[model samples]
Target chain A: MRTGTGAGMPQRGAVGAEERIRAAAVRLWSERGFHGVGIRELAEEAGLSSATLYHYMGTKEDLLADVMSRGLRRLVLAAERVTQQRAGAGPRMNALVQLHVLTHALRPRETRVVDGELRALSGDRRGGVMSLRDEYERYWRATIDEGRASGAFRVEAPGMARLALLEMCTGVARWYDPGGPMALSEVALGHAQLASRVLGAEELELVDEVDWCRGLVGEIWSGPGGG
Target chain B: MRTGTGAGMPQRGAVGAEERIRAAAVRLWSERGFHGVGIRELAEEAGLSSATLYHYMGTKEDLLADVMSRGLRRLVLAAERVTQQRAGAGPRMNALVQLHVLTHALRPRETRVVDGELRALSGDRRGGVMSLRDEYERYWRATIDEGRASGAFRVEAPGMARLALLEMCTGVARWYDPGGPMALSEVALGHAQLASRVLGAEELELVDEVDWCRGLVGEIWSGPGGG
Candidate 1:
């Protein structure tokens, strides 16, 4: 267990007011939507005055863009780490699934806001968020392409496979209940197998990768940067 | 080629003003969400006065509920028709996939509202929409269970597999483009194959089932109930 000393990482035990505001925004925006939630409500949810909320966050859209960018940046970082660590296409894709499943399942609110509220942004903000998202998706794209090229995946349309698998995994956030029957680990493993099936790859045991990605999720989503 | 003579089916060649209002609601709500859009904007979009919009829809929530129920009802009807027409679990699931993909592709806005705006409803209205949705999901559940029981599908968690496949298919509404390279039929066929793969079933030919489902989508989504 390494300490998070990154620039935006929160101190060991202190959760800043800005982090609280971000948490409130993610919760509200995900339950309703970006346009559906108001700053006053957001402030109340975060236990801050409107003026205080405004002091920490510029506008609602700015806060939304900030939230989206931060969430996507974490995903891109984790996906990049997974790619760098796992050389084989099979292992890389499996780790990506586990990481994505864990992220969506554990941080359902933040991931939902990131997935569902992209349309609320405009112009340059939209483009910036989209760029981060594109960066994240490129990892899956490249891994699938690599697998297909190596004859490890047998999908006819690599691009479609990527989109379907991504959506399949992302949907976990919509319906996953922490108190549900299956443990989060089983859900992650099931998705990995499904992704492998979609890509026509041989189903390899992904328990170790899932455990590793679980640690990665904790690392990236922890501290001050944690949502 | 048969006419939609069933009750609630719109007459041929005539788009009623109420239908226009429904279309406007679906379009606006899908873009901005149910709580984000106001009645004035909805009226403006539908080329109706505020009073006229009210005449067509009781309340904003009523309109949202209406949109959701209509969209989901169409799905339930199509799924039922598919089940009646296809007895084998493999063909039944494949046709369900194509019907779902086609519906989502052809009616993205209406489906988006239904998928995203359930929380915007209240009391019995929410319950009603959820029941319709649950009814539709039961078809997928039954088909998957049957497949697994008969050894036609291999999955540890059939429920999770059902959810994964549904999300994967429902996601077509989020990304399918008519002007894109693949024809709608190809998208449908591709998703059917993907579902088959996820179930670990032999990849049977789905061209006929896909074609049949294309017509089924047309029949269910046509007439007065069309979104």
Candidate 2:
């Protein structure tokens, strides 16, 4: 999805300048990464004076902490929502995969900023963000474990499997180009299929199997559609 | 796997100033990421003057480029060596997995800098590094295609399978710590198992499956032992 458009638009509405600054920080942090950007440059990018930025987010590190904490909080919230909607591990995992793929594809910048800029935050901030990340990881781990236990999934190590699945999803932010071949929905679906394979889901029976197989063949022949 | 120590001990052969600078750069880059560390700070961290630092590496960006390029070159070289040694696609893929796992476990910092700092390099430097990376990807892609054609690997899409497998291995650099539970060899082995699974080779009763499985389990339990 294009930035500055859609429902996920940064709150630049009549909101306070502080909110605008935070939104700008998220955008820049995602694009250039925390270490690559400076406070003055970030302020300029946001169309605000460095003094105003200071007044809004306090310090450069503080801006980073705020951006990361807020983004991670959103991720945690999204995971919680998915967990609440789906009862079983398989459905919940599918929901998690969908949520992860959609969020990353839609908010590529924000997700990148949060995932790549963790070390820039101070110790306390880093700890808080990491705790949230661990919690998010736990959800995935539990889902994989449940799938394995229930014979819905066959994986060697649930922990490692979860990590691999998360890595595949997180990498979407790195290479996903909205203008590229595949649509966001398509990428999410492809990722769900790959996740299913990673979890060792049984082959779909007859009717579903042929359709799924055809979809994959179509995807392969399509040749690197939009991320 | 500790920094400043390699397999051989060349007695009385002290590290050159340039080597020391590169070493310092690796440490800083790994800790704070490429764009996070300033030249002056890096010099201070290396216990060298800023002027002296320039004599060793032309610019901060040059330092990053050199580090990334060298690391990627090493990775590519290693992968090539493995491929050359193994005759066919199956054994070649196995070697590639083992080599990749060992490299990640042995040279975690270099792996981190190469994977995380790709954005820091500019123009030709960035293109050069990316080309090398693409070349490395080609090795895996070719192997996957061969396996699929030969009926050794049972994957619906070869390209996506390559990407997924690469993502899984690259993730080792992020969370692997040397001293954790398993040894480096163990972690590499575990990754080999994961790689085999990703390639859809488990269904094939290939030779050396037992060894590959052992390596996979070991790498998993090792958790990137804290080098």
- Per-model TM against the reference: 0.87, 0.80
Question: What are the RMSD figures for all models against the true structure?
Answer: 5.0, 7.9
Location of the lowest summed lDDT over 10 successive residues in candidate 1 chain A:
A6-15
Error of 2 at B72 (Å): 1.4
Q: State residue A47's C-alpha deviation in candidate 1, in Å.
A: 5.1
Go through the candidates in order and give each one's DockQ: 0.66, 0.40
Scored by DockQ, the top model is 1
Q: Write the per-residue lDDT of candidate 1 for residues B111-192, one digit (tens) a residue.
A: 8988888878889999999999999999999999898898888777789999999899888888788998878888888998
Q: For each model, chain A TM-score? A: 0.89, 0.79
Worst 10 residues of 1 chain B by lDDT: B9-18
Clashes per candidate (backbone, < 3 Å)? 4, 22
Q: How well is each residue in A93-190 modelled by candidate 1, as lDDT tens digits?
A: 98999899999998888898989888889999999999999999999999998988988888898888898999999999888889989899889988
Off by over 4 Å in 1: A1-17, A43-56, B1-18, B43-56, B208-211
